[model samples]
Target: MSVQTWTWILVGITFALYFGIAIWARAGSTKEFYVAGGGVSPLANGMATAADWMSAASFISMAGIISFAGYDGSVYLMGWTGGYVLLALLLAPYLRKFGKFTVPDFIGDRYYSNGARTVAVICALIVSFTYVAGQMRGVGIVFSQFLQVEIIWGVVIGMCIVLVFAFLGGMKGITYTQVAQYCVLIFAFMVPAFFISFQMTGDIIPQIGMGGTLEDGTYLLDKLDALHTQLGFKEYTTGSKSTWDVFAITLALMVGTAGLPHVIVRFFTVPKVKDARKSAGYALFLIAILYTTAPAISVFSRTNLIETVSETKYSEIPEWFKNWENTGLIAWTDKNGDGKIQYIAGSAIDGKKPVYTEARGSYGERLIANASAAKNELYVDRDIMVLANPEIAGLPNWVIALVAAGGLAAALSTAAGLLLVISTSISHDLIKKQIRPDISDKSELMWARGSIFVAILIAGYFGINPPGFVAATVALAFGLAAASFFPAIILGIFDKRMNKEGAISGMVVGILLMLFYMMKYKLDMFGGGTQDDWWFGTSPEGFGTVAMIVNVVISLVVSRLTSEPPVEVQEIVENIRIPSGAGEASAH
Candidate 1:
C-alpha cells in the first residue's frame, strides 16, 4: 500500500484497539478512574508506567537529541534512566504505603497543613501541563508530517482520543491503551533499527550493532570517532563536558524523573507497597528496552545521514529529501555555487571558510569534499532521523505506517496519563479536599472527567502551534519540575522537620527561579535574537541542574529555621514509611 493509505489503515486499527480496550476496562467509580481500582498487577502496572513515562520525547526526539548532542547528550540517557533507581529506592514504596490518590495528599498530610497540599497541587498542575504540552505537540507534528494533515487537525484528533480514554474510561482505559501503545511503539522503533543495524553492521540487534564492526572490518564506533576527529568534532563515545556540568545535568534528570508527577502517580496503581517496588523494577526494565536501543539508533542514523548526504549533489538526493525540505527541516544554500553538497566543519562562502561556533559543533558543517564551486549546504532537521528512519533504510510502506501509529501511541499514552494526573489534582486535591468536602464520589468523578477535557483543549492548542521541538519543550518542563516540585517532594518524604512553610516557600522559590532562568535562556538569550547571553555559560538544558540544587538547599535550610511538623504529622510520616498499611489504607 502507499504511505497515505497505510497510514489511514494503521491509524484506524490503532484507534479501534485503543477504544476497544477503553470499553473493556472502563472505570465505574472514582477509585477506578484515579488508580484503576488499585488492582493492577505489578507487571501490568510496570508496563503501564513505562508507557506513561516514555512520551513523545522518548519515542520521537531522544535519539535525535543524542544524534546531535554527541557525548554531552549522555547526560540525557543516564539522567532519565537513573531516575527510576531513585524512584524505586527512595520514593515509590513509601508513596504507595501512604495510599494517596495524588502526590499532594502525601505532602498535605505529612506536613500537617492544607497549604502544603495546595502547593503540591499547583506544582503538579504546572509539571503535568508543561509536560503534556510537549506530548500534544509531538502528536500534532507526527500527524502533520506523516499524514499530511494540518497541525490543528492533528491535535484535534489526539485531543478527542485522550478525552474518550480519560473521560469515558479513566485510568482503567488509559492503562490497557498504554500497554497496546507500548507494544506498537517499541516494535515500530525497533524494526527499523534492526534493519538499519543489520544493513550497516551485519547485526540484527541494534544494541550489539552499536558496538559491532562496520563492513570495512573496523569498529563502527572507531570509524565514527575518526570521522568526528576529521571533522573537528568531539569523539563519539566519550564525554567532552565539564565534570561539574555532567554531574549536575545527570543529577537533575534523575531527580526530575523521579519527581515527575506523571511517573510518580503510576505507583498508586499497584496493590501494595512491595508491588509498587516490583512495578518500578519492571518499569525500568521495560524502559531499558527502548533507552538502550535509542543510543544505537542515534549512532546509526548519524552515520547514515553523514554518508548519504556528505558528497551527494542536492539535486541527486532521494525524493525523501525534497519532502523533508518542504517541511523546512532540510535546507541548502549553495554558498560557493557548487552543485555538490558540502558537509564540512566550517562555512565556505565566496571562497572563504568561516568558522561556526556554538561550542558543541560535534556534527561538522556539511561540505562537498574538494569541490571548487560554491559550498552546497544541507541542513537536516533532527526530528527527521527517527520519524523517517524506516524510509531512509528502505523499509516498506507498512513499516512507515506503523511508525506513524507508534508515534501517535507514544504521544497519546503519555498525554492520557498526564491528563489523568491533572484531572485528579483538580478534582480530588483542589475541589474535594479544599473547595467541597461534601462532594460525592460520582460528582468528583464527573469533575475529574471535566478537568481532563479542559486539559486536553489547553494542551491541544499548544500542540497545534508548538513553540519549539519536543525535546526542547520537555527539557524545559523538566527544569520546571526540578525547580518547583522535586525538592518539595523529596524533603516531604525524607526530612521529618519539614513543615508547610518550608514546602510552600521552596516550591514558589524553585518555580520562580526556574522561570527566570527559562525566560532568559529561551526568550532572551538562546531563543531570542540575542546571542552570547547565557547565564553562567550554561545552556538552558543544563541550567535546570543548578536550579535543582538551589531548590534543595533552600528547602532544607528554610525548613531548619522554621517550626517542625506536628507530632501527628510525624506519625503520618512513619505510617508512610511502613509497608503494611497500603492494602487497607482508606481512600481519601
Candidate 2:
C-alpha cells in the first residue's frame, strides 16, 4: 500500500480508539473533569503523565535538534528528565497531599489570597498557550506530509479531534486516552530506532549501537567525529556552547519542567499522595526510555543523512529527498551549475552565492534555495529528520506510517494536557474560586468545556498564522515557568513564612524579567540587540536561570519584610509534609 494509505489507516485507527475512550470515560462531575475523580492508579497516571510531558518537541524535534546540535543537546535530555526528579522529591507528593484539583488551587489556598490564585492562573494560561502553539504546528507538519493536506487544514482537523476528547472527557478521558497514546507513541518511536540501529551497527539496542563499532570496524563516535571535521562542522562528541550557558540552560529547563502547570496538575489526579510519588517515578522511567534513545537516534540519523546525501548528484538524490523537498523542508541549489549537491558545514564556504536564484523552479525541479552559500547546497529542515528517517533508511511503508501516528499522538497528547490546564485554571480558579463561588458544579463543568473550545480555537489560529514570536515560544514558555512558578511553589512548600506578598511579587517580577529579556533578544524588541548584548553571555534561553535566582532572592527578602502567613496556612504546610494521615488530610 502507498504511504498515504498506511498513514490514513494507522492514524484513523488511533483516532477511533481515542474517541472510543472519550465516549466510555466521559466526565460526569467537576471532580471528574478536573482530576479524574482522584481514582487514577499510580501506574496508569505515570504512563499518562509520560504521554502528557512528551510533546511534539520530544517526538518530532528533539532528535533532529540533537542530530545537529550534537553534544550541546545533552542539556535538553538532562534538563527535562532531571525536572522529574525535582517533581517527585520536592513537589509532587506534597501537592498531591494538599489534595487540590489544580496547581492554582494550591497556590490560592496556600497563600490565602485570591490575588495569588489569579496570578497563577495567568501564568498557567501563558505557558500553556505558548506550548500548545508548537504542538499544533507539529500536527500540521505531520498532516501536511502524511495526509497530503494543507497545513492549515491539518491544524483544524487536529483542533477538532482534541476538542472531542478534551471537551467531553476532561481529565478522566484524557488520562485513559493518554495511556493508549503512550503505548502507541513509544512503539512507533522505538521500532524504527531499533531497525536503524541494527542496520547501522548490527546491534538491536540504539544506545549501544551509537557507541558500537560499525561494519567497517571503526567506533561509531570516532567515525562521526571524523565526518564532522571533514565537513567543517563541530565534532559530534563535543559542544560549542559555553559552559555557563550550558549550565544555565540546563538549570532553566529543569526548573521549568517541574514548574509547568500541566505536568504538575497530573499529580493531582492520583488517588493518594503515595500514588503521586510512585507515579512520578514511573513517569521518569517511561520518559527515560525515549530520552536515552534520542541521542543514539541523533547520531544514527546524522550519520545516515551525511552518507546518503553528500556529493550525490542532485538529479539522482533519493526519492525521500524529492518528497520532502516538495514539502519545502528539503531544498537544493546547484551552485556552480555542477548538477551535484554539496553537503558540508555552512561555515566552510564563504562569499559563494547559490546558483539557483528564482523563487520558482529556477533551480530545475527544485524549489528556490533559502540556504545561503555553505559547504552544502541543500537545506534540510531540522524538524523533518526524524519523520523522514524511515524513508531515508528504506524502512517499510508501515513503519513510516506508524511514525506519523506517533508524532500526532505525542503532539495531541501534550496539547490536550496543556489545553486542560488552561481551561481548568480559568473555569475553576478564576471563575469558580474568585468570580462566582456559588456557581454550581454543572455550570463550572460547562465553563470548563467552553474554555477548552475557545482555547483550542486560539491555539489553532496561532498554528495557522503563527507569529514570528511563536518560533522560540517553547523555550520561552519554559523560561516563564521557571522564573515564575518554580520559585513560588518550591518556597511555598519549603518555607512556612513565605506569605502571599512575597510569592505574588516574586512571580510577577520573575515572569516579567524573563519575558523582557526574551522579547528583547528573540523579537529584537527594546531597540534590537544581539547575543553580544546578552547579560553575562546568557542567551534568551538561559536567561531564565538568572530570573529564577532573582525570583528566589526577591521572594525571600519580601517575605522577611511582610507579616507571616496565618496560623492555619502554617499548619497546612506542616500537614502536607507528613505522609501519615495523608488520605484523611485529602478528605477535607
Candidate 3:
C-alpha cells in the first residue's frame, strides 16, 4: 500500500486501541478523574509519565534542533533529561507522599493559604496551555503531511478525538491511553532509526551508529564535522557557547522538568510514596531510551540529507522535495539564475562574505564552491528531518505510516496530559478551593469539562497560528515553567522554612524576569537590534537558566529575611519527605 493509505490504517488502529482502553477505564469519581484512584502500578505509571513528558517537542522537534544545533543542542538533551533526576530524587516521591490529587492541593494545604494555591493554579494554566498549543499543532502537521488533509481540518479532527478520551475518562482514561501511546510512539521512533543506522553504518543500534564508522570506513562524527567545516559552520560536537550559558540552560531545563504541573500530577496516580519514587526511576529509564537515541537519529539524518541533496541537480530533484518545498519547508533559489543547483560554502549568497575565516576555523578548512556555483541556497525546515527520515533512508512505506501514527500519539497523549492539568487547576483549585468549597463533585467535574472545552478552542487557535518554530516555542514554554513554578515547588518540598511570602515572591520575580527577557529578544519588545540583547549573550532558548537562578537566589534571600513557617507547616514539610503514612491504596 501507499504511504498515505498505510498511514490512515495505522492511525485508525491506534485510535481504536486508545478509545477502547479509555472507555474500558472510564473515571467514576473525583479521585479517578484526578489521580486514577491512586492505584497505578509503578511500571504503568512510569509508562504514562514517559508519554506525558514526551510532547510534540520530543517527538517532532528535538531531533531537528539537534540536527541544526550541532554541539549547542546538547544543552536540550542534557537539560531535559537531567531535570528528571531532580524530579525523582528531590520532588516526585515527596509530592506523592503529600498525597494530594493536584499540585494546588499541596500548595494550598502546605502554605495554609488559598492565595498561594491560586497563584499555583494560574501558573499551571499558563504553562500547560502554552504547552498544549504546540502538541495540537504537531498532531495537525503530521496528519496534514502524511494523511494529505488540510491543516485546520486535521487539527479539528484531532481535537475531537482527544476530547472524547480526555473528557470521558479523565485521568483514568488518559493513563491507559498514554501507556498505549508510549508503546506505539516508541516503536515508531526506533524502527526507522534502526534501519537508518544499519543503512549508514551497518550498526543496528542508532546510539552506537552516531559515533560509529560509516560504510566508507570514516568516522560518522568526522564526516559531519567535515561537512560543517565546508559549509562555514562550527564543529559538530563541541559547543561555541560560554560555560555559564551552557550551565544556565541545562539548569533551567532540569528545574523546569521537575516543576512541570502535568508531569508532577502523574505521580499522584501511584499508590504510595515509595511507588512514586520507583515510578520516577522507571520513567527515567523509558525517557532515556528515546533521549539517548535522538542524537543518533539527528546525526544520521542530517548526514543523509546533505549527501542526498548535494548530489541532486535542481531539475532532477525528487517528488518529495517538491512536496516539502511547497510547504516552504524546503526552498531553493538560484542566485545566478543557473538551472543547476549549487550546494557549496561561501557562495550561498550573492554578495555576503563567507561565515568562516581560515584564521579561526576550528571546524577545519572550508571547501568553498565544491558543487556548482549558481549560488543556490537551500532552506530546509528543521521539522522535516525527523518526519521524513524513513523516506530519506528508503525504509518501507509501513514504517513511514507507523511514524505518522506515532507522532500523533506522542502529541495527543501530551495534549491530554496538559489539558487535564489546565482543567483541574480551574475546577479543583479555583472553583472548589476558593469559589465554593461546598460545590458538588458533579459541579466540579462539569466545570472541569467546560474549562477543558474552552481551553481546547484557545489552544487550537495558537496551534493554528503558532508564533515560531516548534522547538523555540517549547523552549520558551520551558523557560516560563522554570521561572514561575520550579522554585515554588522545590522550596515547598525541600525547605521547611520557606513561607508563602518567599514562594510568591520567587514565582513573581522568576516569571516576570523570564517574560521580560524573552519578549525583549523574541517579540522585539525593547526595539529590535543587536544592542537589545541578553545580559550575557545568552539566547532566548537559554534564558530560562538565568531566570531559574534568579528565582532561587530571590527565594533564598526572601526566606532568610522573613520568619519561618509555623510549626504545623514545618511538620507538613517533614511529612511530605517521609515514606510512611501514605494512605490506603485505591483499586487499580
Candidate 4:
C-alpha cells in the first residue's frame, strides 16, 4: 500500500477510537469536565499526564532541534525533563492536597482575593495559548506532509477534531483519550528509532546504536563531527552557547514545567495526594522512554541527513526531500547555479524561513524570494526532521504512516489539555467563581464548552501564524509560566504570610517583563534590537529565568511590606502541609 493509504488507514482507526472514547466517557457535570470526577487511578492518570505533558514539542520538534542545534540543544532536554521532576516532587502532591480544580482556583482562594484569581487566569490563558500554538503548528506540519494539505487547512482540521472531544467530554474525555494517545505516540516514536538504528549501526536500540560504529568501523558521533567540520558547521558534540545562557534556558524550562497550569491540573484528577505522587512517578517512567530516545534519534537524523543530502544534485535528491519540499517545509535553491544542494551551517535565506516564489529554478528546485547571498542553499524546517526521518531512511510505509498518527496524537492530546485549562480559567475562575458565583453547574458547563469553541478558533489562528517553530514556541510558553505562576504558587504554599498584593504584583510584573523581552527579540517589537542587545546575555528563550527570579524577589519584598494574609488563608496553607489527616481514602 502507498504511504498515504497507510496513513489514512492508521489515522482513520485512531480517530475512530478517540471519538468512541469521547462518547463513552462524556462528562455529565462540571466536576467531570474539570477533573474527570476525581476518580482516575494512578496508572491511568500517569498515562494521561504523560500524554498531556508531551506535546508536539516533544514528539516532533525536540529531536529536530537537537539534530540541528547539536550539543546546544541539550538545554531543552535537561530543562523540560528536569522541570517535570521538579513539578512531580516539589509541587504536584502539595497542589493536589490543596484540592483546587485549576491554578486560578488555588491562587484565588489562597490569596483571599478575586483579583489574584483574575491575574492567574490571564497568565493561564497566555501560557496555554502560546503552548497550544506550538501543538497546532505541529498538527499543521504533520498533516501538510502526510495528508498533503496546506498548513492553514491542516490547522483548521486539527481544531475541529479537538473541538469534538473537548466539547463532548471535557477533562473526562481528554483523560481517557490521552491514555490511548500515550500508547499510540510511544509506539509510533519507537518503531522508526528501531528501524533506523538497526539499519545504520546493526543495533536495534537507538541509544546503543548512536554510540555504535558504521560498516567501516567509524564511530557514529565521530563521523557526524567530521561531516559537520567538512561543511564549516560546529562539531556535533561541541557546545557553542555560553554557560550562562545554557543554565538560564535550563532553569526557565525546569521552573516553567513546575509552574505550568495544565500539568498541575492533572494531579487534581487523582483521588488522593498519594495517588498524585504515584501518578507523577508513573508519568516520569513513561515519559523517560521518549526523553532518552530523543538524543539518539537526533544523532541518527543529523548523521543521516548530512550523509543523504549534502551536496547532492537537486534533480536526483531523495523522494522525501521533494515530498517535504512540496509542503514548503523543505526547500533548496540553486545558488551559484550549481544544480546541487549546499546543506551547510549558515543562513540559507535572508529570513529565518523560506519565502517561496511561484516559479521554479533551472534545476527544478523551488525558488525562494529571500534567498541569502551566502553560499548556503538549503532550508529544512526543524519540525520536519522526525517526520522526515522515516521517509529519509526508506522505512516501510506502515512505519511512516504510524509516525504521522503518533505526531497527531501527541499534538492533539496536549492541545486538548491546554484548551481545557483555557476554558476552565474563563468559565470557572472568571465567570462562575467571580462574576456569577450563584450559577449552577449546568450553566458553568455550558460556558466551559462555549469557551473551548472560541479558544480553538483562536488557537488555530496562532498555529497558522506561529511566532516560531514548535519547540521554540513551547519554550517561550514555559518562560511565561516560570515568570508568572511559579513564584505565586510556591510562596502561596510554602509561606503563610504571602499576601494577595505580593502575588498579584509579582505575576503582573513577571509576565509583562517576559512579554516585553520576547517581543523585542523574537518579533522585533518594542523597539526591536539585535541578539547582542539581550539583557545580561540571556536569549529570549532563557530570559524566563531572570524574570522568574525577579518575580520571586518582588513577591518576597512586597509581601514583607504589605499586610499579612488572612488568618484563614494562612491556616489553609498550614493545613495542606500537615501531611496527616490527608483523607487518603476520600475523593476531593
Candidate 5:
C-alpha cells in the first residue's frame, strides 16, 4: 500500500483507540478530572507518566537536534534525563504525599497564601502554553507531510482531536489514553529503528547497530566523522560548545524537566507515597527504552541523510526529498548554477529558513525567495530528520506510516496532558480555590472543560506560528518553569523559613528575567543581541540555570529578612516530609 493509505489506516486505528479510551474512562467529578480520582494503580500511572514525559520533543525533535548538533546536542539528552531523575527522586514523593491536585494547589496550602497560589497558577499557565505550542507544532509537522495538508490546517485538526478526549474525560481520559499512546508511540519509534538498523549493519538492535560496522567493514561513526571533514563541518563526535555553556545548558535542561508542571502532576494520580515512588521507578525503565535508542537513530539517520543527498543532482533526488520540499522544510537553490545540492556547514539562506517564491527553479525545485550568498545550497530543518528517516532509508510503506501515527501519539498525548494543566490551573486553582470556594463540583467541571476548549484554541495559534524549533521552544518553557517554580517548590519543601513573601518575590523576579533574556536572544525583542551578548557565554537554552540560581539567592535573602512562615505552614511542611504514609498528608 502507499504511504498515505497506510498513514490513514494506522492513524485512524490508533486515534480510534484513544477515543475509545476517552469514552470508557470519562471523568464524572472534579476529582477524576484533576488527578484521575487519585486512585490509579502504580503501574498504569507509570506507563501514563512515561507517555506524558516523552512528548513530541522527545519522539520527533530530540534525535533531530542531536543529529545536527553532534556532540554538543548531548546537553538535551543529559539535561532531560537527569532532570527526570531530579523530579522523580527529589520532588515526586514529597508532592504526592502532600496530596495536592496540582502544583499550585500544593503551593497555596503549603505557603498559606492564596496570593502565592495565584502566582504559581500564572507560572504554570505560561510554561504549559509554551510547551503545548511545540507539541501542536509537531502535530502540524507530521500531518503536513503525511496527510498532505498545510501546517496550519494540521494544527487545527490536532486541536479538535485533543479537545474531544480532553473535554470528555479530563485527567481520567488523558491518563488512560496516554497509556495506550505509550504503547503506540513506543512501538512506532522502535520498529523503524530496528528496520533501518538491520538494513544498514545487519544488526537488529539500533544501539548495537550504530556501533556495528557497515557491510564494507567501516565503522559507522568513523565514516560519519569523515563525512563531516569532507563537508567542512566539525567532527561528528567532537563538541563545539564552550565548556561553561555546555554545563549551563545541561543544568538548565535538568532543572527545567524537574520544574515542568505537567510532569510533576503525574505523581499525584497514584494511591500512596510509596506508590508514587514505585510509579517513578516503572516510568524510569519505560522512558529509558526510547531515551537510550534516540542517539542511535540520530547516528543512523544523519549518516543516511548525508550519503543519499550530498552532491546529488536536484532532478534525480528521490520522492521523499521532493515531498518534504513541497512542505517548505527542505529547500535547494542552484547557487552555483550546478543544479546539484551542496549540503555543508553554515546557513543556506538569508536567515535560517528559506522564503518561497511563487515560481519553480530550472530543475523544477522550489525557488528560494531570499537566497543567501553562502556556498551551501541546501536547507534542512532539524525537526524533519526523525519523520523523514524511514523514507530516507527506503523502508517499507507500512513502517513509514507507523512513524506518522507514532509521532501523533507522542505529540497528542503530551498536548492533552499540558492542556489539562492549563485547564486545572484555571478551573481548580484560580476559580474553585480562590474566587468561588463554594462552587459546585458540576460547575467546576464545566469550567474545566470550557477552559480546555479555550486553551486548545490558543495552543493552535502558537502552533501555526512557533517561536523556534519544537525542541528549542520546549527548552524555553523549561527555562520559564525553572526560573519560576523550581525555587519556590524546593524552598517551600526544604526550608522551614520560606514565607509567602519570599516565594512570591523569587518567582516574580526569576520568571521576568528569563522572559527578558529569552525575548532578547530568542525572539529578538530587547535590542536583539547576538551570541556574544549572552551573559557569561550561556545560550538562551542554558540561561535557565542562571535564572534559577538568581531565584534561589533572592528567595533565601528575602526569606531570611522576612518573618518566618506561620507555625501551621511549617508543620505542614514537616508533615509532607514524613514518609510514613498518607496518614497526615491531609494536614493544612
Candidate 6:
C-alpha cells in the first residue's frame, strides 16, 4: 500500500478504537466526568496518565529537538522524568488524600478562600490552554502530512475527534481512551526505534544501540561528535548551553511537570492515596520507556540525516527529502551554485541581505543559502525529524502508517485531557464553586461540555499558528505551571501556616512574572530585545526557574506576615499526611 493508503487505514483503525472506548466508558455523572467515578485502578490510571502526560511534544517533537540540540536536549529527558519523582514523593499521594475533583479544589479549601480557588482556576486555564495548543499543532502536522490537507483543516479535524470523546465521555471516557492510545503510541514509537537501531548498530535495543559501535566499528557518539565538529556545530555529547542555563531549564521543567494541572488531576481519578502513589510509579515507568529511548532515537536520526543529505547532490536527494520539502519544512539555497546542499554550521554576518531561495524547474532545483549568511545551506525544521524518521530509515509503508497513527494518538489523547481540565476549571471551579454553589449537577455538566467546545476552538487557532516549535512551546507551558502552581501546591501541603494571602499572592506574581518574560522574548512584546537582554542570561524558557524561586520567597515572607491558615485547615493538612483512613477522610 502507498503511504497515504496505509496512513488512512491505521489512523482510521485507531480512531475507531478510541471512539468505541469513549462510548463504552461514557461518563454518566459529575463524578464520572470529573474523576472517572474516582474508582480507577492504579495500573489503568497509570497508563492513562502516561498518555495524558506525553502529548504531541513527547511523541512527535521531543526526539526531533534532541536530534538537533544534541546534549542540550538531555534537559527534557531529565526534566520531564525527574518531575514524576517529585510528584510521586511529594504531591500525588497527599493531593489524592485531600481528594477533590481538581487542583483548584485543594487550593480553595486549604486556603479557606474562594479567591484562592479563582486564582488557581486562572492558572490552570493558562497552563492547560498553552499546553493544548501544542498538541493541536501536532495533530495538524500529522494531518497535513498524511491526509494531505491544509494545517487549518487538519486542526479542525483533530478538534472534532477530541470533542467526540471529551464532550461525550469526559474524564471517564478520556481515561479508557488514553489507555488505548498509550498502547498504540508506545508500540508505534518503539517499532521505528528498533528498526533504526538494528540497521545502524546491529543492536535491537535503542538505548544499547545508541552506545554501541556502528557497523563501521566506530563508537556511535564518537562519530556523531566528529560529524558535528566537522560541520562547526557543537559536539553531540557536550552541548553549547551555559551550565547555569541548563540547570535552570532542567529544574524548571521538573517543577513544571509536577505542577501541570492536567497531570495533578490524574491522581484524583484513583481510588486511594496509596493507589495514587502506585499510579505515579507506574506512570514514571511507562514514561521512562519513551524518555530513555528518545535520546537514542535522536542520535540515530541525526546521524542518519547527516549521512543521507549532507554534501549530497541536490538532484540525487532522497524521496523523503522531496516529500518533506513539499511541506515547506526542508529548504535550501545554492548560494555558490555548486548544485550541492551544504548542511554545515556557519556564523551570521552582519549587514547581509538574506537571499531567499526557492525550488525551481522540473528537477526541483533550488539555491541553498543561509538566511543569516551562515555556512549551512539547508534549513531542516526540527519538528519533522520524528515524523520523517521511518521514511528516512527506509522502513515499510505499514510501519510508517503506524507511526502516523501513533503521533495522532499521542496528540489527541493529551488534547482531550487538557481540554477537560480547561473546561472543568471554568465550569466546576469558577461557575459551580464560586458563582453558583447550588447549581444542579446536570447543569454543571452542560456548562463543562460547552466550555470544552469553546476551549477546543481556541486551542485549534493557536495550533494553526503556533508560537514556536512543539517542544519549545510546551516548555513555556511548563514554565508557567512551575512558576504559578508548583510553589503554591507544595507550600500548601508542607506548610500548615501557609495562608490565602501567601498562596494567592505567590501564584499571581509567579505567573505574571513568567508571562512577562515569555511575552517579551517569545512574542516580541514591549519593544523586545535579543537574548543578550535576558536577566542573568536566563533564556525565556529557563526564566521560570528564577520565577519559581521568587514565588517561594515571596510566599514565605507573606505567610509569616499574614495570619496562619485556620485550625480546621491545619487539621485537614494533618489528616492528609496520614495514609490510613484516607478513603474515608477524602470522602468528607
TM, every model: 0.90, 0.95, 0.91, 0.99, 0.98, 0.96
Clashing residue pairs found in predicted model 4: none
TM-score of 5: 0.98
Report the number of clashing residue pairs per model. Answer: 13, 1, 1, 0, 0, 7
Which is the winner by TM-score between candidate 1 and candidate 4?
Answer: 4
Question: Over the full model, what C-alpha lDDT does candidate 5 score relative to the true structure?
Answer: 0.91
**RMSD in order of candidates:** 5.6, 2.7, 6.3, 1.0, 1.4, 2.4
- What candidate 5 gets wrong by more than 4 Å, as runs, is 582-588
- Give the Å shift of residue 524 in candidate 6: 1.5
> How do the residues 472-568 of candidate 4 rate in per-residue lDDT, one tens digit apiece?
9999999999999999999999999899999999999999999999999987888988978989999999999999999999999999999988898
* lDDT, residue 244, candidate 3: 79
**Candidate 5 backbone collisions, by pair:** none
**Ranking of predictions according to lDDT:** 4, 5, 6, 2, 3, 1
Q: Rank the candidates by TM-score, best first.
A: 4, 5, 6, 2, 3, 1
lDDT digits (tens) for residues 398-443 of candidate 2: 9999999999999889989899999999999999999999999999
Best of the candidates, lDDT: 4
Higher-ranked by lDDT: 5 or 6 = 5
What is the C-alpha lDDT profile of model 1 across 1-588, one tens digit per residue?
788799889888988999999999999998899888888889888888889988999998889888877787778888888877888888887777777777887777777778888888888888788788889877876877665655567677778867887777888889888888888888888888888899989999999999999878999989888877776667778876777767766776788787888788788887777788888898889999999999998998788777777777766876666555444445555555566666765433322222222332112233323223423355555666788777766778898888888888898999999999999999999999999999999999889988988888888887755545677678777877877777777777777788788888878888777777777757564355233565565666667777777777877888889887788877777677665556566333
Q: Is candidate 1 or candidate 6 better by TM-score?
A: 6
Name the runs in model 3 displaced over 4 angstroms.
149-153, 343-376, 529-532, 580-588
State each model's CA lDDT, in order.
0.78, 0.85, 0.80, 0.93, 0.91, 0.88
**lDDT per residue (tens digit) for residues 298-385 in model 6:** 9998998998988998899988887766655667666556878788886322222223355473447533344555666777777778
Q: Which portions of model 4 show Cα errors greater than 4 Å?
A: none
- Candidate 5, residues 1-588, lDDT tens digits: the string is 999999989999999999999999999999899988888888999999999999999999999999998999888989999999999999988888777889899889988999999999999999999999999999999988976766778888888988897899989999999999999999999999999999999999999998999999999999999999999999999998999999988898888888888999988887778888898999999999999999999999999999999999988999999999888888889888888899998778997578888988779998998888889888998999999999999999999999999999999999999999999999999999999999999999999999999999999999888989899999999899889999999888899999988899899999999999999999988789999889999999999999999999998999899999989888988887877646345332
